[model samples]
Target: MSERTRIPPLSPFEEQAGFTRALRAGNRIVVSGNVGVEEDGSVSPDAGKQADRCFALIREYVEQLGGRMDDVVRVRMFVTDIADADAVTAAFSRALGHVRPTGTLVAIAALYHPSWKVEIEAEAIVGDE
Candidate 1:
């Protein structure tokens, strides 16, 4: 049987809302959608900036669990504005350019927060260190 692990969300509200930031089983790790909102509850206005923050959060969680950005095998992006695609993807690419994980980008009608232009999710696999 494979082992399972859970990484708690950064905020108590997230815990109360019924979800964690990430979950892992064996070598596979799945991170929940991450927004640019910081610990102080501040969000960026630009999609690119938001993407940067999201990737940082995901990278942190992945590394904490014994994995690296290069280990990421898949990525998904939820973008509020189609025009912001370039900015969002640019940030995503910068974060995983060498790794180049399989990915998809979606233009959504809106997000939980109107100011949030983008949210990102990532999946990674740990292989022999």
Candidate 2:
């Protein structure tokens, strides 16, 4: 059996705090909750834009682990306001398109950032050769 490997994100927040952003075990990759913060740790303006940024960050981690967006099997979205669901879904659909993965959306009071409207976490599977 091959040993599990962890693919940590290179975020200053995580790096300074000594934590990994994601872990890869065998053919599965589990990503930590990702906020819509840019590489410089700035949150976007609104839910729709944040949703798009979240997916962009997720895609970065997914590709790092030898997988694509289509390889994602599950996703969890956290939103501060229920009213943003439609906008969030629209952004999500634009990113994932027909590759609909199992998803869950929850309304939360707030996120790590004051302006962050959405946060996402995901899991993907890479088939063994």
Predictions in order: lDDT: 0.91, 0.84
TM-score of candidate 1 to 2 decimals: 0.92
Alpha-carbon runs more than 4 Å astray in model 2: 15-18
Q: Compared with the true structure, what per-residue lDDT tens digits does model 1 show for residues 45-117? A: 8899999999999999998888899999999999999999999999988999889899999999999989999
Residue 62 local lDDT, model 1: 95
Give me candidate 2's TM-score against the actual structure: 0.87
For model 1, which pairs clash? none
How far residue 81's Cα lies from its native spot in candidate 2, in Å, is 1.0
Which candidate has the top score in lDDT? 1
TM-score for each model: 0.92, 0.87
Candidate 2, residues 2-116, lDDT tens digits: the string is 6767676475878788777777788888888877877776776778988998899889888888888888889899999999999888887888867888888999999876788
Candidate 2, position 115, lDDT: 86
RMSD of 2: 2.2
In model 1, the Cα lDDT at residue 45 comes to 88
